[model samples]
Target: MGSDNTDRNKPGIANFAALKTAIVNGEDQLVRELLSHEPMLDIEKSYLIDLAQLNKNHTIIKLLENISVKK
Candidate 1:
């Protein structure tokens, strides 16, 4: 039988709202922790990058970029 990797990769957050909040508020550590916990789709990563760009958070933007690349 095949193992269920999909569930294992699920994000810890209940929803995107929390992540959006963290990104909008410039919470780099929280963002890092959240992102490290799981994987996100390319579109989701793009949206997060946009939000980080809007807030001018280069650190978070870079983090997102790195994660996106790794994924």
Candidate 2:
């Protein structure tokens, strides 16, 4: 795991990049892992939803929707 101080200073763009790569690569496990590690990483305004739509990944969309509902 990254150091707490380092992780806190990490830019949100880095998290967005990782999330985009994970979604595009169809690495659902990686997506979950990234989300788990960066629970504070914001996804609502990211391109993740657009990627899921472009790829017709209904499962991911549903998962995102479920998460949004919970929040």
Q: Which lDDT values do the candidates have, in the order given?
A: 0.79, 0.63
lDDT of 1 by residue, 1-71 (tens): 23466565454445567778999999999887777645678888898899999999999999888864325
Q: Where does model 2 exceed 4 Å of error?
A: 1-11, 36-46, 69-71
Position 37, candidate 2: lDDT: 29
**Best candidate, TM-score-wise?**
1
Superposed Cα deviation of residue 35, candidate 1 (Å): 0.7
Give me the overall lDDT of model 1. 0.79
* Residue-wise C-alpha lDDT for candidate 2, range 6-44, written one tens digit per residue: 878676658667877877787777776666422342444
In candidate 1, stretches whose alpha carbon ends up further than 4 angstroms from where it belongs are: 1-15, 69-71
Residue-pair clashes per candidate, as listed?
A: 0, 0
User: For model 2, what is the error of residue 42's alpha carbon versus the real structure, in angstroms, after optimal superposition?
Assistant: 8.3
